[model samples]
Target: MMGQFDKNALPVAIIGGGPVGLAAAAHLIKKGEKFIVLEAGESVGSSILEWGHVQMFSPWQYNIDQAAKELLENAGWTSPDEEALPTGRELVEKYLLPLSNLPEIKEQIMLQAKVVRVAKKAHDKLKTGKRDTVPFQLYVEANGDTTVIEAKAVIDSSGTWTNPNPMLSNGIWTNAERQLHNEIHYGIPNVVQLENRYQNKTTLVIGSGHSAINALLGLATLQQKYSDTKIYWVLRKKQIHEVYGGQENDGLAARGELGIRIQQLVESGRINILTPFHINGVYPTNDKITVVGELNGEEFTIGDIDEMVVSTGFRPDTSFLNEVRINLDSTVESIDTLAPLIDPNTLLG
Candidate 1:
């Protein structure tokens, strides 16, 4: 089918099939440009499905891209209310599924296709002449088979879902932490459905973001039914009140309610909150997991944790992009051009 198009013309490549990647495809289609979307998962929005049970803080208006909205509207699809927030599942099923089904997009997207490497065709990093004209060579692996795709340009909206940051405050990956991967879960798990697993067990929840709050709240709910279960909320933040975000003054009701709910749980003495804890390491100690850290410039250790829920957030994976020449911030991992705009103080606000 690709042979039908001009052999001299290469399709632009978009490296993810999530909302941003799909939106890029729509815009490319509007401009009458050829493009292909490569998705690493089994289907579109596969990453979003991981948190499908959680409702988004933002409503549909801010979530949907303009190009995608137009594409769906042109297909006679009536969208959900702009003010109504949807869960991750609803976003995928009601939006991404329909967008992927569009002939313009469906035929161009490759599911279960993981991009392993990207580089300029017929040239190494050292070579320079005519490099701009050379198409990008993307090596994609699917079912153990590798295929090379030539793209005129690459729009990498691959995202950062797969690469979660560690709970260690020093920001280092230790050997001890590597062995505990099975015992620790990075994102929010369906705590409600895991009552049997967490019932009467002591679980530690890390990070002060909404992710941490959700995990703590879920475990607290579990504790209500099973009083033996204990929930610990740990963070490196100096002040616990900072995580509350905007309460009644917030525009988004759902986001504000999360802080309010978690604050109430903490005030009720349902959650054992720990802050300013600098995680030193996590390792096995006599068939039990031990979390060693620091608090108030003093050494501290917490043990007997049955399970750990880490909401430490994720970083963008640029391992494959090493071959591709692009400017990326050393710290935040965002595009170098936009990295300056990020301020940790105002970010949570």
Candidate 2:
């Protein structure tokens, strides 16, 4: 249920209920400040819930925050004891939920409320020249109705963990084919669908990141059971070992093993490893997909691919903040740290 606000009750409004936003709420609560957190999804940690099946590389110690840890420990919340990394679901249910259930934090969050617009309130004409407190108007839609909230400051921790960048390819591929191939299904937690589709046929995986490695490994696992399937890993670099940089020794080892396995597949002629090349476009050829590319100044085409997995990374979601007067970095899609400076007291950008 939506609660009635007195318009001047809360000094700050937070958009998003992820870890960063929740941590900000904890800080605000500790300082005895009134604030509200608006979450567009059914619960906090909506992105975590979406990737529930995928295990995070970071351990609990790295993932949980000091504020959350203190709150949960004080409440006698038992943390998961598994030495192995926790899946997204486990992190949400065990960490986020427990932290959000704290009395101080729970009351501050409003779930399923989407913030559509944020605008600065116009000061009176006479008061324009004077230094006055700037009010932020937040337009929110919740439960089929529109609501407005005004706050002295706003913090946006709505990162791009929820939005993923689609595969960047030449425009030769049809929209239907892209959807069917799952090329646009960026940041999908599982690769079973792609594995199944490429069964008994050649699959081309492009990229040098962990995503590409994971997809290739999954496809190789499937090929071991299914006799007719084949895999080809294509990278712009000269070798696969260039992408195996991970902080954890085990992580590095696991990635190295995948690289070695790919090499072994190439040696055994089970999988083809194409290096120093880039895909130009995808053309439909009757029932198969043909990938055309360039290698060492010579143009080549790899045909009869049943599926293609592109592991291109994502950029942050900052388009909505363009009109908010927050300075952004020119080279990268991120908020500028120095300009349109954040207030140390309010932490508002």
The candidate that wins on TM-score is 1
Cα RMSD of all models vs. native, in order, equals 2.8, 6.7
Per residue, candidate 2 scores C-alpha lDDT tens digits across 46-143 of: 97687576666566777777876777788898767635578788888888888888998898789999888776665333344321455677889999
Cα lDDT computed for each candidate against the true fold: 0.88, 0.69
Shift in Å, residue 105, candidate 2: 2.2
Please provide TM-scores, in order, for all candidate models, with all chains considered together: 0.95, 0.77
Q: Please report how far candidate 1 places residue 159 from its true position, in Å.
A: 0.7
TM-score of 1: 0.95
Write model 1 residue lDDT over 241-277, tens digit each, in one string: 8888898877899999998998898889987877888
Top model number, lDDT? 1
For model 1, which pairs clash?
Answer: none
